[model samples]
Target chain A: MSASLPYAVHETAGHDNASMTTVGFWIYLMSDCLIFAVLFATFGVLVHSTAGGPDGKGLFELPFVLGETMLLLVSSFTFGAGMLSAQAGRKKQLLAWLAVTFVLGLAFIAMELHEFSTLIHEGAGPSKSAFLSSFFTLVGTHGLHVTCGLAWLIVMAHQVVRFGLDGIALRRLACLSLFWHFLDLIWICVFTFVYLREFL
Target chain B: MKAPLPHSGMEHAESHAHGNLKSYVVGFVLSLVLTIASFGTVMTDLVPHASRLATIVILCVVQLFVQLVYFLHMGTAKSQRQNTAIFACTSLLIVIVVAGSLWVMHNANVNMMPMSMSIQSALKHP
Candidate 1:
């Protein structure tokens, strides 16, 4: 059956176009999730291969990770708030919340980069061991996604300023909302699997 | 300059674009609690220490559901059934791929590391 058939009854929402886009986007996200799953599996397989370099137990600072987690979690909430403002047709509040979220995300990336650089300075660079390699790859990939998300947020804010809550703007923001929250979801997994497990 | 999202006069569209504030606040609070609980369990040497990892994984799963429902708005709703199906399938694949690799690698390590270790020791001694 055509994807468009499902929303035929509710054409008033103009979801005739948006529903298909949303579903297509969801499928894309699921594919991206699979990529993460593969990376996570690689990390699991190589977790013990420190090759005389530092392991997670010696390297991960939970308190620092917790701080980063707080920033990301708060940013996710602020983006949610921004989406709400967009729904209410309040473009100014939407932009404000997006800006707040962007700053929080930026701070997270800065802390992450600092953490990486510090690790390299300590000679625990990814090339030092298999464990470090997987760690950097998985965490670095997530960081890169957040970086792209920050850029997307900036673009969406520019779009909102120009177009207000028009159909296209709203739909794009909705997609970005899903994406931003998805990144937070991935971070939860990262901190749990990569950081907290170090305590064990 | 301001109109309530012209061209889509539907409640579902609004909810889809932006869930209500109550859900957002509730999800945020629940996620916050879950994160802290996981952190505290690890830091405080509580939960008998050995099961801390299990507890954290469980809490992480719960938090995932909380965010999925409230923030991403995935649920049994007709609109989300496809999303749910897709997620369920991906989860199955993730389990297979991750668990399969771990199982194979663990066995390989069990079978191979000792021979290498013995070789190293033999070389060291003779």
Candidate 2:
């Protein structure tokens, strides 16, 4: 019966390939990290150059930002659940968790978009000041990455359904999980250095 | 159903590949706590000014590692060793580049004597 376990052979056989894929994806994520690092450095340098425009204290709303943080963090947790389901070869659970992750991700993006629109409407658009420029660039880049991740989640969910947690699909799902969690990691930095620090 | 051999290296190894639900929950809880701590430190005037920044930074760093270890399942296992090295090197480079550039730019600002006002004066005088 152990020999006949459906996922056992595939799990063993896919180990090497999965390892390679995981490593490769990690390298990609590291490069992405560098991109964020540059944005962060730029933001740091320009944070004080408000050019008579509103500063973080006036621009950032803690409660709204906190809501966004909660959504992303919970989505990361849901993505983890999906990955666990994938590992267990429970396709329905995987799909359910992924669906939840996707919805939470969408909510995050919606909140971000709303914030951006509010800022722009308040005459704090990126071009209005150097501080705003860096702010938008740093945070907008993150929002863009989240958008892309959502798209990838959709593709991966579709693949899981089509492939039924085959070795390849499962490996791809693992990569996506890493990506999702990594975004959450970056968001922690953003929340601390950008939003919360404003109050300090 | 035959019991899996206890000494089967592959089975033992694969067990560590995909993390279980417990570890995921652990990571989630840790991160949530750290996040709340960060928010509390900033939202309230509880922490002293000098140490508040430090506290927030420490919280962020700890939460980052929690996500990495629990959610991402990153570790020093043999299979993950290479990826870890790659990440460590990339992180070092990021620190150098970001920190170095910011230091240089800040130092330049310190040396410069209010150039924007001077620029206005120059246009007026010329």
Across A1-200, the per-residue lDDT of candidate 1 in tens digits comes to 23223332454643466766787898888888989999999999999888767899898899999999999999999999988887677889999999999999999999999999999999999999999999999999999999999999989989878756677787788899889999999999999998999896
Model-by-model lDDT, in order?
A: 0.85, 0.84
| Top candidate by TM-score | 2
> Which parts of model 1 are misplaced by more than 4 Å?
A1-15, B1-17, B115-126
Estimate the TM-score of every prediction: 0.90, 0.91
Model no. 2, DockQ: 0.55
* Residue-by-residue lDDT tens digits, candidate 1, B5-94: 334455464354456787889899999999999999898866887788789999999999999988998876656677789999989998
Candidate 2 interface RMS: 2.3
Best by DockQ, which number?
A: 2
TM-score (C-alpha) between model 1 and the true structure: 0.90
DockQ of each: 0.54, 0.55
For every candidate, how close is chain A to the native chain A in TM-score? 0.93, 0.93
